[model samples]
Target chain A: MIAAIRVFGYSLFAIFIGLLFMGIGRKIIARIQLRLGPPFYQAFLDVGKLFARKSITHNFVMDLGMIMSLAGLLSTMLFVPVAGHMAIKTSSNLILIIYLMAIGHLGMAMAAAASGNPNATIGVSRALTMMLGYEIPFFTVMLGLIIFNGTSSLELIAQSQAGGILNWNMVKFPLGFLAAEIALQAIMGEKPFDAMVAPAEIASGPMVELGGKYLGLAFLTHAVSIFVETGIMVNLFMGGASNVFTFVLKQFEIYLITILIEAVFPRFRIEQAVKFLWTVPMSIAVVQLAIILL
Target chain B: MMDSPSYMLSKIAEKDNLTVYELFFGPNHPGMHGNFGYVLEMIGTEIVKVRPNAGHLHRGFEKLMEQKLWVQNIALVPRICVADPDPNEVAYCTAIEKILRVDIPDRAKFLRTITLEMSRLSSFLMGMGALAAAVGLYTAMNIMTADRDLILDLFEWLTGARVYHMFSIPGGVRNDLADGFVERLYKVLDHLEKRLIEYDKLLFENPIIHKRLKGLGYVSKEDAVKYGLTGPNLRASGNPYDVRVDDPYAAYPYLDVRVITQEGGDALTRAIQIRLEFEETINLIRRALKTMPEGEIRLNLGNLSALKVPKGEAYAKVESSKGEFGYYVVSDGGMKPYRVAVRGPSLPAGLLLAQKHLPKMKIDDVAAWMASLAICPPDIDK
Candidate 1:
């Protein structure tokens, strides 16, 4: 019962932090454009409003897919150690976390396909293609750290870099961190790599068919994924914090970098994005892997 | 009755391995400029065929102008192109002046030039913002819109109306420059010039934007002229056919109007052309202000409501932000015009060039492409 309570508390914490970061990100973007933005709690208000409205569902598959998407990301969030606190107290295997994260995307893809909208299908296809683009460099960076530390566990990786800021992987393996940063931008679906969600091109792509409660659920899923992805980045690059507050601070810093990049850059075409991902970050990751091997 | 038509077609499609779907790419889509649509047939995110769906914004503007008296048509002409309405008014008035063979006063000419250039600035801002937004950069859009509001504020101060300023009539503009207007104009110009550096950092210098826009829409020099492309789009394609320079009107003949052109006939070249022309327009306005002479503002036509023109026909054209806006007016010695035909700039590009360029292009490029061409749909429909 205590474990179940802890699990629920962790999910809520992740969702809250994620929503806060999104709101703050919008505020920062608006300031960059020389305008006053919404309050920092606006995402919460938006989610509340969406949930209060009615939703249209195309089929049972769509309903199941939306639920599965949220559930899968939530499950991934449970494995990430928050300031040394684990929800379920498992190994928190890095490979398992990566594998589980994909389930969230697959769930979204299934839902989009089931929606029977051409735009949604195109968005899902681009998303899956983008997955292929970013994963190679991301996994190569992970492989470098795994080989260096001789462990596949995220907790072990974080603990190894716990002595000081200088001991963090970000300082020791700057190339790998750079590659990971680029991959993270794509993972979060920010520009100049946001072709899948290209609002002008495909009428907001996958979200075209989503409305009301379904949109609310989509927002929650996006929030959870943001938390999970940033949490993973903090554990791998920065040393995971000694407390929950500092941990969230570290996650915010990572998210801030992505948001700053997202503010000024326009989207890349899917093929252009894939080509860039393969050449630039992929080369950087390869060089980092060589350094680790050498 | 062996097989239903749908089933037979499906079987044929399956045998051929074709999966083409129709997508309505406007009328309500975010990328669309106005109430215009394109029915696109797609096969795997690439456009297989395109059917331009016009007439969504058709208000019968040409037909509406025929019913109104000569002077009242000034209020209606500006609605033809909301982004750059001054050109429509100027073109209409110039056509009427040509038919009447009356030259507007020198002060009125300078004022008209200033308003026309200011309208060009605001329209260019909107065009660049729309282009940036099409590529998913809302920051650029927001900044440009904020800057455009400054121009609109100036317009309101001068003309008493913000958007459709019915300032220009048959003879001259309705009002003079307001109190301390030139100093305020200078301040706005200085502020915009400073903001250009920030825009460079945020949008123009960004490498991804160059990559996205460099060679997307390649119109050759010959094709540009063949397709009747004009203004910046034509100038970008290595043509120096500016109505302001070649066929001078307003204060253009008196002032030193320098024609700027580019060698590459691509989308990026066109964007660069607009940026360079925006700076040139600022200089043009400053020059016009400096050289403007104080004189009468209009030719007294005597009771404009009951005014009549001798039976004649004349055509007048002006360099709008989009391209050449021409008004062909025919008078029958009556209070109302016999015929008024507007030659809008966007019709050829929106209807003709799109047919040539849109097929085989990916879905993502459509919005950016439309924005690069600066295809305003209202003018096309009108």
Candidate 2:
């Protein structure tokens, strides 16, 4: 029972951290260009209002989508270590986390598809194409970890790199971490890679069809996703929660990187996105793998 | 729209469970720059068939001009196109000028160029925003609007209104450049030059945008002319025809402007052409301010209460930001015009040519192609 509470606590905490970063991130990006932006609590207010409205689902698939996303989110949380330890860090659970992430997207896509809007379908299609593009490099990065750590267990992987915060995957394989950083930015659906939700092209893509309570759930899933992937990056590459300030520091850095790129770059179309991931970022990941093999 | 060849797409699906359906991308989609759409037939991933639909915004500006008074039409002409309204006002005014044999003061010409160049910059900014949005770049779109707002602020200072400046009147302008406005404009120009570099980093140099826009909406030189494409669309296909040069009016004959063009008539070419034009517009404004002849801005409409002309018909054309806009007027020695047919360039470029070109692109690309054409809805509806 204590294990369940621990898992729930860490997972919720990570999500809260991500939620906090979204509003703060926008303000920082705005100031970089000599302008003032919204306050720190804006993210909370925005998310809160989304729930204030009654949940309205376009169809039964919408119901399934929210439920499945919540389920998959919890399962993935079981594998990710927070404060240097996971609630249930079994070896195979780390692999399960990857599947959960993939399946969570699948569920969201399914719901978006069932909304019966062309824009939604287009959004889902772009998201699928992006997933296909970014996942290859992500797997390669993971393969390097599995080979080096010699275990699928995320906790074991974290423990192997434990030191006075200097020994981490980022320091050991800087190239891999660099490649992963760019790839994760794409994976997170940040700006310059957010083709799926292109508002001008398809009216915010898939979310165009979803409204009311379904949108609220979808928004939460996205907010949590920012944390889930960022937490994984922190644990694998950066030292995992060495202290509260360190944890906050690393998370903010990740968020800052995303915002900076977003403010400075334009988006790619689906075809361009596919070509970029398949060529540039993928080649960089291969170079990272080559260094490890040598 | 005529039939799309549908030759490029290879069939991946069998006849049985998956049926091919035609989806009409109407005058309603966000991508459809103000009243434009395409008929798209898709069998899963590939677009096997397409057709461009237009004319949702046909207001008959030409036909309407014949019914109104010579001065009354001045108020109506600017409504023809929302993005660039100055040229229509000038085109109509110049045609009336020809009928009345009124030689506009040198000062009026300089002030006219100032407003015209500013309108061009504002229209191009709007086009940039629309194109960015169509290519799925929300950040680029927002950034464009943010920068475009500064230009609008300049317009407000000049004309006291934002969207519909109706500032260009017959014979001369409504007012002169206010105190220190020219110096302030130079500052705005300086700011614009610096912002363009950041815009390059955000939208232009970014490889993703290049991939999406570079070669998507391809139109050849011969085809561009045959289909009546004009303005940047015509120039993008390697044509150097601008009414500001080919016909020469206002202050363009004295002003030095090298026409901007690109060999490939695609979305990227259109976008790049706008960027080049933006730099040139700043140059044009600076020259107009420097060489502004000291004179009155407004010409009295009271000179023609009866609005009598020499009973001879005249036609005048001006290069709007969108394309070449022309006005052909026939006066019968009356207050109202006998007939004033306004030939809006966007009609041929957007309605007729949109039908011609949209068939060549995928359903998702419909908006980008439409925006590149730069069709203002009021112009089409008129």
Candidate 3:
């Protein structure tokens, strides 16, 4: 019962921080364009409004799929160590976290297919293809880190780099860091790599039929995923931070960098985006892996 | 579940020749610029057929013009083209002025030129923003829209209306330029000139934008002329045909209007051509300000309600932001025009040209192609 309460508390904390990151991202993009943006807590209001509205369901799968998507991402968050503590205390294996993350995306894909929209299907297919394109390079870079540290537990890898900024993996593995940055851009669906959700092209792609409560659940799932992904990046490269405040600040910095790129660039076609991922970043990851092995 | 889905699959597979899926591409959608829909027959992702559906913005403009008196039609014509309404008002007024045989003052002509260029600047900004939006660069769209609103501020100061300004009347403009309008306009133009460089860096030089738009919608020089494409679309195809230069109207006869052209005849060329012409439009506005002839701002056409035009017919054309917008007016010695017809520039681009080009394009390119062509649905439906 105590563990259940802890799990609930951690999920709420992750969601709150993730939604705050989203709101700040909007403000940053707005300031760049010389406009007064929404308040910093606007994302919370948006989710609240979404939950308050009525929703339509095409079939039983839509509701089940949405709940499954949220559940999948939430479960992934449980395994990730936030600052220095884990909601569910098992040795944090990097490979387990990666595999668990895919469940969330697959659940969303199943829900999108259940919606019976061609745009949704096309979006799901492109999203899956993009996942394939980014994962190869990401795993290669992660493999280099795992081999160098001689451990797969995220907490141990982060603990090894805890002395100072100079000891962070970002300073040591510069080439791997660069490759991982590009991979992260694709993973987060930022500009030049966001063809799956191209609003003008496919009418918002997978989220076409999602409305009301279903959309709220989707938004919550996205928030949790953001926390999980950025948390992993911080633990891997930014020394995991000594406390919660510093950890969240580093996550904010990473999210800001992504939004900065998104504000300036246009989207690529799906094929071009995949090709770019495979050629440039993949080769860089291979070189980084070679150095780690030697 | 397996039996149900298989039955449905077999039902779909029964039609061997019907492999295409039908999609309604927006009478109401984010990608659609306005109230326009396309019944697209798509095979996989490629568009196999395109049936352009319009009339959502139709207000019976031609018939409505026949009902209103000569002076009242000025208010009606501006509604025909929302993005660039000045062209319609100017064309209608010029047509009636031709029938009434009243020569507008030089100041009015120059003022008309200024307004026309300002209208073109606003419309081009909207077109550029839409092009960016189509390619998923919404930040660029927002920036362009904010800049376009600055120009609208100038319009509000001059005409007391933000969008539909019934400034142009039958004989000339309803009022003269407001106090210090030239100084404010110069400032706006300077700001826009500086912003264009940033816009180029963000969108024009973007590798992804180049990949998506470079050769997507190709219109050859011969095909352009064959299909009656005008404005920047025709200019992109290496045709140096501009109604402002070849068939000068209003103050265009006095001004040296340079017709800009490009050789590519593709979407990139069209976009670059508009950017280049936008600079020229800014220069033209400055030149008109420097050499504006001083005289009466309007011609008194007697009491508007009692005014009667002689029995005659005249067609007047203006080089609008979209293309050549012409107004044909038939006056049978009456207060109301006998017959009025609008040769809107968007008819050929939205209906004829879209039908010809949209057949083989990938469905994703449909919005981008329409944006580069700058087809305004209101003009088509009007």
Candidate 4:
């Protein structure tokens, strides 16, 4: 019963931090464009308004898909060590976390495909193609760290880099961090890698058919995703902070890099984006792995 | 009875077990510039065939012009191309002036030139913004829109209306240069000049933008001429045929209007062509303002409502932001025009070029292609 309460509280914390980051990100983007943006609490208001409204569903699969997407990400959040605190007391396995994140994306693809809109199908295909593009470099970077640290556990790696800033994996493995940074940009669906959600091209892709509560759920799923992805990044490279506040601050720093890049850059075509990922980041990751092996 | 090309294609696709689906890409889609749509047939993400679905924004502009008096049609003409309305008014008025055999005062010519350059600046901003947005760079779109608003503010101060200004009439502009308008115009130009460097950093120099736009739509010099392409699109393909420089309409002959052209015949070249011309337009406007002679703003045709033209036909053309906007007018020596046909700039690119280019292109490139070509839907439908 106590463990269940801790899990619920941690999930709420992750959602809140993620939503806050999203709101702040919008404000930053607006300022970059020389426009006054919405308040920092705008995402909360948006989610609230969406949940209050009515929604249409194509079928049971859509409902299941949306729920499973949110659930999958939320469960992945449990595995990520936030300030050295795991909601479920088990080793934060990096491989399992990565595998779980794919389920979230698969759920969204399934829901979008079920909607039967050609644009949505195109979006889903692009998204899946993007996933294939980013994951190779991402896994190669992770493989370097796992081999160097002699473990696939995220918490153990964070503990190993606990001495100081210089001891952090980021400083030691700069090339791996650079490769991971590029992969993270795709992972977060930012510009130069955001063809899947190209609003001008495919009417915002997978979210085309979602409305009302379904959209609200998708927002929550995205918020949780931001938390999980950034959380993993911080644990991997930033030496996972000693407390929650510092951990979230590090996550914001990571998210800030992506938001700044997102604000200025135009999207690449899916093929172009995939080709770039395979060439640039993949080679960087391979070089980093070579350095570690040597 | 069942011998349609689409049906035959579908049957062939079914034999090969290829799933072909139809997607409507506007009238409601965000990427579309106006109330225009394309019925796109697709296999996977590539567009197999495209049927341009127009008439969504048709207000029967040519027919509407016939119903109104000659002076009253000035208000109707600007509605044909909302983004660059001045070209329509200038072309129509120039045609009327030609038929009447009236040489507009030198001061009026300079004023027309100023207004024409201003309109081009506004249209280029919108076109560039739309192009950036089509590639998913909302930051560039937002910045360009904010800058465009500054021009709109100048327009509102000069002419009481922000858009659809019936400022340019047959004889001259409705209002002379207002008090201190030139100083304010210069100030805005200076501010825009500073912003251009920032725009270069944010959009033009962006490598991803280059990757998305480079060679996406290749129009050769021969194809550009054969397809009846005009304006910056034609200029981008190494063609130096600028209506302003070649025909010398309005005050262009008086001013040092140098024709700007690019050698590369691709979407990126077209974008750079607009950027180069935007700078040239700013310089041209500054020159016109400085060299403007002080004289009567209009020819004072007594009671313009009762004015009639001689039995003659005249076609006058002006270089708009999109291309050459031509007005062919036939007057029957009556209060109203007998026939007025507007030759809109967007027709060749929107209708003709899209047919040639859109097939085999990916779905993502359609909006960007339309934006790079500056395909205005209202002009196409009109």
Write one digit per residue (lDDT tens) for candidate 4, span A18-125.
899999999999999989999999999999999999998877888999999998999999999999999989998999999999989999998987776777878989
lDDT of 2 by residue, A119-209 (tens): 6777888898999899898878877888777887776776787786568888888878888888888888986788788765666777876
DockQ for model 4 equals 0.56
Query: In DockQ, how does model 3 score against the reference complex?
Result: 0.57
Tens digits of lDDT, candidate 2, B1-382: 1221111111212332345645556666666666656567665534566655556766776777778777778778888787888888888888888887887888888888888888888888888878776765556666667777887888899889886676766677778888988888889888888888877776677676677677866778998888777788899889999888888888888888778878988888888888888888888888878877797776676764456555878999988888888888898878788888877777776657665565545555666777777766666566
Q: Taking the tens digit of each residue's C-alpha lDDT, what string does model 4 give over B41-154?
A: 888788888889999998998888778999999889999999999999999999999999999998888888898899999999999999999999999999999999999888
Candidate with the larger lDDT of 1 and 2? 1
| Candidates by DockQ, descending order | 1, 3, 4, 2
Q: Which of the predicted structures, 1 or 2, would earn the higher DockQ when compared with the native? A: 1
Instruction: Answer with 1 or 4, whichever has the higher DockQ.
Output: 1
The true-versus-predicted C-alpha distance at residue A154 of model 2, in Å, is 1.5
Please identify which of the two predictions, 1 or 3, would achieve the higher DockQ against the true structure: 1
lDDT by residue (tens digit), candidate 3, B1-382: 5444423533554564647766778887778977988988777778989999897888899998889888888888988898899999999889888998989998999999999999999999998999999998888889989999998998898889888888888778878887888899999999999998998898888888889999988999999999999999999999999999998888988889989999999998898888899999999999889999888998988887777999999999999988999999999999899999999888888999898899998877888999999988998888
Native interface contacts kept by each candidate, as a fraction: 0.78, 0.36, 0.62, 0.81
Worst 10-residue lDDT window, candidate 1 chain B: B1-10
In terms of DockQ, the best-performing candidate is 1
Task: Give, for candidate 4 chain B, the lowest lDDT window spanning 10 residues.
Answer: B1-10
Off by over 4 Å in 1: B1-18
Tens digit per residue, CA lDDT, model 3, A121-198: 778888898999899999999999999999999999999998889999999998998899888888888887998898
